[model samples]
Target: MPKSLIASAEWSLLLSRLRALAPEAFDSQGRVLNLVAREWGNPGHGKPYLSPVDGSQLGLLPMIDLSTATHAVASAAAEAEEWARVDLDTRKARVSACLDLLHENHELLALLLTWEIGKPVPQSRVSVERCISGVKWYVENIESMMEGREPLGLISNIASWNYPMSVLMHAALVQALAGNAVIAKSPTDGGLLSLTLAMAFARRCGLPMSLVSGSGGKLSEALVRDPHIACLSFVGGKVNGRDIAASLYDRKKRYMLEMEGVNAYGIWRFSDWNQLAKQLKKGFEYGKQRCTAYPRFVVERGLVPRFLEMYLPMLTSLKVGHPLLGETRAAEPPSVDFGPLINSGKVEELHAMMSEAEAKGAIPLYKGRLEPNLFLPNQDVSAYLGPCAFLHVPRNCRLYHNEPFGPVDSIVVVDTEEELVTEMNVSNGALVASLACDEPETARRIASELRAFKVGINTTRSRGDREESFGGIGQSWQGCFVGGAYLVQAVTEGPPGERLFGNFPDYTLLPEKR
Candidate 1:
């Protein structure tokens, strides 16, 4: 048998601490979490949880029976009702305490994220920090946001694995702060860390919720179909999102769908190529696994050569290695830019996509190669793939239209703003897009024409301020927008008058008395 990846003294110590908290989940042999059933009576039926960084077995996740799953949902609903009666201020205090707990255990969460999802420790730390910030923001603004709304009862939150910590938990925490109970289903690939975080929140906040683990097969289907669940919030692929939307529509339940799309990045001739290259590197920060990562690059015809010259080298220079072994820096790491893809199968799929694009007349600018240091002797290295770039990909190619949720980029040159806008909207609709131009007038014009929810000027990063409203247009999203004041409204229902203190006016002194 292969040696444990947590063999280093520091890693071993962290694992020991985590095991102490959840003894039934983490062990020296391997971490095992009973996701489905509480007891592992039949060990043979459990599924293996593989670490994307090393292709090693991290633990086994039990597949619970349907009756057990239903019980979990019912418990969550009952707890949510009880929680709804708690004073809003008391709930805010609990949420604040939970955020403090998360901050205190930041290191452990970062380490677990590095191993579970193949994100570098530095990047994982940033994600944890973002979660803390988001929670803090939601808690501070909760009273005002919830002032005009009533809790929507029970929220069935289904999150994706790409960003298990911040992206998933942000919504869950928001719903909780709005006085709604949550029944969260974490993705199977990254369930352990998410479960750990959720359990920590429950313990610290004394909140009512259920954090379950399983492939979104029968268990999730049951969750969405449950008549008791008031709303369904999902972040994942378009296909599964569509299925959930249809089910929710049939049941007459409110739902929020954040589906995947082929997001784009546009560069005008006047854009600063050097600084633009720096920002564009964010596109592949997590091997382009994020929904907001721009996979399509639409460049002006005059600037194509300059953009490629500056961008291809930056793409090639990115370090691909084990998530834990990479060097950490204060800001973004100069040497190591990203870690591995999710798994070996994903790596293979990305390579196949690149090959298909090349076969269809796409010019390979930098065909990435895995470094020798990325692998251990006798250890499977299939999960790791270096960054790849292609230029002048044909418009009809699938790579041009599809979301290549990996570290693969396609550059297309357009001669005019009209052509550029056409190319930008070619994906039908997207979550967001970034335009790099020097003129403010041009930026404003492009922003107005974009079909995206958010447009960045002279920036490639997808994330906006925590207080800003975010979502997509057309097929990219459904229901309503998310984040800021919008998020608090989505998880709850009814107008201000229906809420507990909605009918009351602000306290004031009479002008005559003064």
Candidate 2:
């Protein structure tokens, strides 16, 4: 059996001692410690941080007062010029050193991520690795991407709870590489540990912690409105992203919005069922919390019965249990394939959405069950919802267009290639669409017609290649792509002529008579 990912006795003791010495620095009860410039401040009112694993109250996450937040933004603004002036080699070295620091502390961060966000230890570790890889990717590609571009001054990175560390690290590293100072706002839920650790590592590399730490709705709005913040990178729900974009429109501030999508997948008649099933299972990863998860499946009419026979059983067999449990534990069940939602509220929302679909005449292929006995002793299973499959969903049902954002699957049947593409394009917007067609021409046709930033052939999951651009079209994204070469552009600005390599005819030179 493999060794446990949970912290050992010595590490646990050390963490406990640190917490005891600075109780306020950690969230306890209804109090939280806000970090700014290496100083921990308590702003009084805070929200509770509940453990998704057991629905237990972990502690409180403190909110930053608007005044203090403003001061922090000013500090970041002042620091931007100095940071921009630093040599490119020195900046790259600093970023590389920070990556090393993250690797050295991977275990602690992974454990904290699991406890705070309810992600399994293995998956949490993957997130940390992804963060490290993002920094390295930015450092390696920054020079070419920046070319003649100038820094956009201070950038405000507002991150979301799902995959918080990866998103924050990706935005911060790329922005900093482009010589922009950044102030990253932690998500209201499950961002305390990841953001705090990242701030500490960044400060050690000579960046100010205040430049990257602070949390509060009003404070976040202020940051968006602040003229000094030249760029804003946000990752969250579509509604909030729209609000941020609207706020920035008048300011003419450069911003990149990474919003959620109701990603879809098309299964054709010739598609391999076994291979397709494997790809479809990824939708259940993290219990469909991922924005890229394929919630809607468009199956060919003739293939629907065979697809259901192969898919429903797999979804039903998924283990829903504590994320931290080890597969090697004799007394415990195997490692879980599905964990609880972020909180009990999410569970309720998912059930409501599913019930609405059922009421709208959708046939339930597999109704999900909530087993209280599946969890550990004293743990609340109310937040745990098992995987569900639905078939013959009506086009008018809310589930047809809305992203359930839970372990729920809706299968829509289509007769022809045109019908399949039409159904895939029904979502208001989508980041990606997966095509499981064997014919190259069919795949190409569907990919071109689908209104999404990315179209995968025979692959259901989002790609991990750092060189690939990641973003959506229409309502899915309000700005430029978030990763790859586009990120440098997202955080910097320069004249149009600077982006042009060769001399071209000036538009003013067009025939004077015209």
> By summed lDDT, which 10 consecutive residues of candidate 1 come out lowest?
505-514
Per-residue lDDT for 90 in model 2?
Answer: 88
- List, residue by residue over 404-482, the lDDT tens digit for candidate 2: 8888888989898888888888766688788888898877777778877778888764735477666676677776565
TM-score of 1: 0.88
Cα misplacement distance, residue 3 of candidate 2 (Å):
4.4
| TM-score (all chains, Cα) for each model | 0.88, 0.90
Q: How many backbone clashes can be found in candidate 2?
A: 0
RMSD of each: 7.2, 5.4
Q: Please identify model 2 stretches exceeding 4 Å from their true place.
A: 1-32, 37-39, 209-216, 327-332, 370-373, 461-465, 497-514
User: Cα lDDT of all candidates, in order?
Assistant: 0.72, 0.72
Q: Can you list the residue pairs that collide in candidate 1?
A: 36-64
